[model samples]
Structure formats: C-alpha cells, structure tokens
Target: MKNLNCKNCGGPMLIDPSGTTANCPFCGSKYVLDHRDTDYYRDFYERMRGFLHLSADGQERRRRADELWDSAASEVFECSDGRQIDIRSMHTYKNRIMTAYTARQNIIFRFDIGNEDKADRYRKNVSSIDYPSADTRSLSDFFPRISGGFELADATTLLVVKKREDEYPLRLFGTLSGRHTAWLIGRMENLCCVLEYNSIVHPEFGLDTLYIDPYDHQASLYGGWWSAVPNNTAVNGRICTTRDNLTALRETAAKVLGFESASAARETEDVPKPFADFLRSTPLSNAYEDFAYWDDVLIKSYGERRFINMETDDKQIYGKGQ
Candidate 1:
C-alpha cells in the first residue's frame, strides 16, 4: 500500500528509510521498497492524509490510466527466445492520480524474463551497470532485436526479454531526464520521478494491473481485474539515453528526476500549471517501434533496445573476424 512512485510518471517506487533512495518509470531515467510492520502501517495511515487522500480529479486520472494499461498490456508479442507473451496491459501504477488532469503521452516498454530465480536475483538490488542492464548496451544496440518482436506484438504493446537482466542488481529502471538512474547524485534535492506500469487484458476478457516496488531493482508481474484507459497516441520523436551519462549531464539540468521512494509527489504549488501534461499519462498504442511517443514523431529509438531469437543480426554471413 505504501511504496515510492515515479514523480514524473507516477508508477511505483522503492525508498530507503532516510527517504533519499529513489527509482522511476520510463524515460528521463532508464535512470534509475519496503514493507514495514502492520502496526507501523496502522499508525502511518491513521495520521497521514497526504497521498492517501485522492481528489476527484486524481481518481478520474487513475481510471483513465487503467484504461491505457488495458489497451497496451493486453496485446501480445513474440520474444527473441521464441516465447509468445502478451503484454497484457498498456500501463498500471500503484496509487497515483492527478488533481489537474495533466496527461503526458509517453512511449512505454515491458519485458518479461524466462526464469524466476534470475529475476529475483536482479530484483535484489540496483545493478552497478546500467538500469535494466541488458548487458551494458545503450537502448540503441538492441533496437533491431526489439523491432523484431513487432510481428507478434502488432496493435499490442511492445514487451521483450530485457537483454541486460543477466546483469544482476540492475533489472528495474526509470530515467529522469537521462540522468544517473539508480544512484543519487550530490544532495539530489528538488528532484522528481514518476513510475507507471502496463495493465493486462486476458483472452477471456479478464484483466489485471501491475505495480513495481523499487524497494529493489526487480520487476514483479501480477494480474487482476482493473479498469484503465489507454493513453492517446500522436506523432513524436524517440529519445534514447542512459542513466550514468544522464547523471553527468544533469550537473545543471534545471529539473532532474530520480526513482520513487515512499510515494513522493509534488504538490500543486511545487509544480507549474503549464507542464501538467508531463505529470500525467495517456493510453499507449502498440503500433509504435517502442511505446507512446512525446509528440508522435517517429524513427528515433527510445531507451535501451531488446532481444529476439532467430531473427538476429547475430548472423555473420562470412564467419567471425571476417
């Protein structure tokens, strides 16, 4: 019930007791929880009216988000390993809503791993490598592999077997302005991160929503009947970045982002009215080479690329070292 969430996208979060650690969803990050005692929750909820209390607008925004989740995740995609998996939803988040109704269109990616033990190992901590590690290649490297999954994922959201999951302690990721993803940069205050996940719709019309617990860099896929509206689509360019490099660039990035810890969000006064769209999310379409775009301009690959099985450029027509 209580976890950190992306300040920019409002997905899910992981936080440390000091309330300094963070993680986020989608771009700006690629960048970058916990359970306490029951008694602690009782006392916490008893007095905290902060995010627990949602405004009418917030509730509505959540409903719309759920729809988007359904539209995206429900669609299936064929992975490089020859596994046919359904994204099941466009997007989903823990407990996030908006009062101003600022919905931002974003490209989202979902990936499922083949082994649970491997997943758990990756989930245990933020990797020293890149966020969503996938073998240290920038989102650019695997664009071909990710593009290959498009055949099975048409009209369905693009989900893959993240190439970097093998790089343990770095499986989960959220980027804030393309900065250092899992680590905190000096005094990293006034920063915000938003996390969101895809929703699922089954072949039988059953549905469920998933939420990430940044408490550790692990992705836990779950199912349930939830309501959601897909974020609308438009034309936009795809932006690619890595957390490590982004962190260095943000030495003066004005507004920087980090993952979520303890459901942190910006109050109305803290955020400007003009950029509300950046704070909100809309339904996403699977037609994209990636997820939803910022403005609908295509051709640019966003985030790290994915992997595919047989259809690989892995083939060297003339043999190795040719």
Candidate 2:
C-alpha cells in the first residue's frame, strides 16, 4: 500500500470512510479522486469483497498468501554481555510510556527510560485480574499474559507479552460501520465489568490499547496495563475510577463511528438513536450498572443480538494505495 500525501502541503492525507475523498489533517486540504483513481479503488474493494465471500479453506489459503506477500522487518539489540537479540516485527505502536512491536505470537513493549517500575506494575496488574467461578467465557484469556522481561544494554526496559496470532490492533481496522462498532462496544463492556469486579481503573483504555479478532468478533485489552491502577486512586491530581473505563469505551465507539467524541456522535439511519444515546449519555455509577444499561441500549438499537460479519482487508481498512 502506498501512503497518500496532500498535494497542497505535502502532508499525509486521511481517507474518508467513503474512500473517494481524503483530507489532510496537517493542512486542512481536501482531495477528491480522479476517475482513474476511483476505478482502481472500486476494483480493489470488489476483490476484497470477493475474498471475504470465499470458503473458510479458501480464506485460509489467501491468508497464507498474504503472509508470504508481507515480510516482517527485523531489528537487532545488544545485551549487557554483548549478546545480540533479533526481533522481527510486523507492526509498531508508540505511546507516551512505551513503544510496542508486534512480533507474530508476542508483543514486545520497550518502556521509556526511568519507567521500569511501570513495566513491573503492568505485569502485576494483569496477573491480579480475577473472574467469577460461573464465568465460562474464559475472559482472562483476553488480558495480557507476561512471557518475560528484559533490560537492554541501552538502558531501556522490555516487557514481552504473549498474544494470539489472530489478534490485531483494533486501530488497524480504521473507521468501522455502526454495526461493527456496536459489537465492539458490547465486548468492551464485558471487559469493563471484569475491571470493575477487581476495582481496577485503566486510564489508557481506548482504541490504541485494544486488540480485535475480527473473524471471531472478539476484543482484547492487550495494551496500556502500565497505566492501570486501582479504582479511586489519585493520578495526576485527579481521581481515577471504573467510570473512566466506561467513558473510554464510549469514546472508542465514537471514534470508530467517525466522530471525534461521544458527545459529537449524531443519529443516522446506520447509527440509530439508541446507539448514539448510549455513547452520549453519562455512564452509570459502576461498570456493572453501566453494562446493564448498555444491554438495554443494545437491544433497543438493533432489536436482537445477531453476529454481523464485516469482511474487510488491509486496503479496505487503511485505504487504497495506503
């Protein structure tokens, strides 16, 4: 995929959900595709849709071919004793506290200098999560599982966590349909309930911290554990509570619906009033109550629970020629 740049200011352009237009976030430049460009994107979208309609075995073969089409980039790091470790990564994510590299079956988080304690906190927080005995959902599997930790010779700390091969960062999907975002919100509500059950407040709970198995319609909290704390703990001169988690969920839903914030979400044919109201309304006292409220909204929004399969590929998600 080729990155699209703004012709006016030479800045990167963000493709709209319609895929025929783009906007430059840096320079406020807008671009509409020419006829030739539109035809190319139309053909690309058709091929992606055809791939999605393929049989399970056919999809598997295509996935294998995609793996061969894309190669992981490698980086070498030296240990204190002069030993070298090679990391082959397919994707990289950066936040204030750490830079994460997606290395097939594991995610390697390299914490900023002087933030080693946060790395330890991450491990402890994930390990402390508890689930009810009657919970057959295996909710714990979605949280991070610490594989190992290391101190590089460069003084940065690395925390290695295991992840499933099928899980990809939710942000990789870009903006999704309202139906897709609805299911994501339901999954997030389940996760928030678990956090509330343990009285944990995850400050950085949002799209960047989330992973999704689109094929299974499942979501996972795979990042931002370093910033997680117990409910009501004071952080940066403010109280953090379970409410923060619910709020983040709403914000994430709004983002996938192409809105800047929950308050900005408007009702449309696709995004019904109930769905918009859920995002805009204030969260209930705790995650339990909030989730129950969302359950009501979910039914009101779509009437009944049905798994809607959203078939998409990298080009359809990130954008054509990007």
Candidate 3:
C-alpha cells in the first residue's frame, strides 16, 4: 500500500489501505482519497519532470523556445518608464509553444502562440479564457492540466532566467520546491506542520511542517498558483496526499510564475453553503445513518468527484480533456 502525507499538517498520513479517507495529524480533519485525483496530477507531474531529465530534447526545446521569443520580442516597445516587456510564460504543447508577455509590473501583456501540436491542450485553455488581472493574460486553461504536487517528486531540478537577448525564456535560474497534492486535501486536524521533500538530504527542521484552516482558499485542500502549486495549499501546511502523487504528466514547463497577479490568485474557499445539504453527500459514517441500508453506502474518498465514479471502474484518463 502506498503512503499518503497529510495536506493539512504535513506529517505522515494515517491511512487504511482499504479505506478511502485519511486524517491529518496536526489538525483533526478528514478527507476523501479519490484515485482519479491522485493519479491525474501524478501523471502530469511525472511528465513535466521528465522534460527536465531529457538530455537530448532539453536543449532543443530551450532553443526552439528562444527562437520563438526572438520573433515576438520585436513587437514589444518601451513602456513610459523604459521597462521592458517580454514573454513571461512559455507554455509548450506537443510541438507548439504559446508565450505570454507582460511588462512594467504587469501593466501590459500579450501572447505569442507558435508550433503545430494540433492536439495541444495549452492552446485550448489559455487562448480563450478571460484573464483576471486587467493587463496580464489569463492562463487558467491549464488549470485542470498542471493541477498539483505529484509533478514535484519528478522535478529533480529547476530552470529560471532573464529574457536573454532572448535567451531561451526561463533557462537556468532557481531551485524549485514542489510536492504531492491530492490526498492532502485540507482538514482541521493535527494542527501540525512541516516543510517536506522526499529528497531533502540535509538536516532541515524535519520533513515539512504546515497548519490547517479549511476556510482559507490557500489551504492545502485547494490549489495555489503563485506558490508553484497546481493545487490549493499554503507553505507551512500539512502534506499527506495530492493530485501530483498520482499523475503521469508529459511535456511540461513551469516556474515560480508570479504572485497575486491572476484571477486564479487564490483558492475559493468558504464553508460550503447549503452546508447541511452538502453534508448529506459526504460519506461520513453518521451521514449513512439516515438510511437503513447504511453499511452498503460507501463513504467516498476526497469529495464529489470520486463519489460519482465509485461504483464502477474508473474510465477517465489525464490529458484527454482534463
């Protein structure tokens, strides 16, 4: 049985292999562990991390990204303060890459879409969605694609840099800190926390530490974009499980994108309204109390997503729509 960490307290998870839920050590909250959520992000993370490991394709992709940036750089003109505007995001699909540009503290923005991956999901998500901040383009289209920590385990390195006379955008700059995202859905348990990374070889304050507050959109339960996260989680939060642990993502690109600059600025958290009605769907033991055939009703892991696919074998695949 694979182990899952607490997304709330960032401690070892107490999970029953046969059970669908797990509890947080620091905060005392329960979460449903759905397989789909776990596997999808895991695939996504692995795929992206693979891109970092490829000795042959890495240079080619970076070179191509640079060439594309060169063609678009000419379009940028000086801002009133002479601040430069250049590609901020280089989102690559099978063959094509879409580069987004923003300048002067994000006051101006544009995008450069190139390549030929007709099956490209990046093009679909980013091209049409309405961006949140006025000047910057919205990149939410990849919301379902790059959604969590499973991708982090595969990331043995990171790439960060300046716009080079158009050096390949975002090449060799900083170390990345990522993690598993799904099973770690937030709960009010343990109230324990730590910083975590399976490969931290040095004496760090222990693995990972975190606090749990279900109401915070930035809570481990939801996804946070700026924090280099595909799911909603805050630093110093728990680390049991996440979508990243289970995905098989391929051909990926990301960096410390930016903060408080997109519509997806934070998680949308609130005590679920119709709180009582919503509770009816939760697979809590007492929730099955109202019905006589209670034992037959299984409490799902995570939330509504798994609840729907529970009875039958799962048929969904990542990168196929999500």
Top candidate, metric TM-score: 2
lDDT of 1 at 28: 33
Give candidate 1's error at residue 290 in angstroms: 31
Local distance difference test, each candidate: 0.25, 0.76, 0.25
Using lDDT, give the best candidate's number. Answer: 2
* Count of clashes in candidate 1: 93
Model 1 per-residue lDDT at 321? 45
**Which residues of candidate 3, in runs, are more than 4 Å off?**
1-53, 56-58, 67-322
Following a full C-alpha superposition, what root-mean-square deviation does model 3 have from the true structure? 22.6
Stretches off by above 4 angstroms in model 2 are: 1-55, 58-65, 68-71, 134-137, 307-322
Q: Poorest 10 consecutive residues of model 1 by lDDT?
A: 186-195
lDDT of 3 by residue, 270-295 (tens): 21222212223322322112221221
Clashes of each: 93, 0, 69
- Candidate 3, after superposition: displacement of residue 71 in Å? 5.3
- As a whole number from 0 to 100, the lDDT of residue 235 in candidate 2 is 94
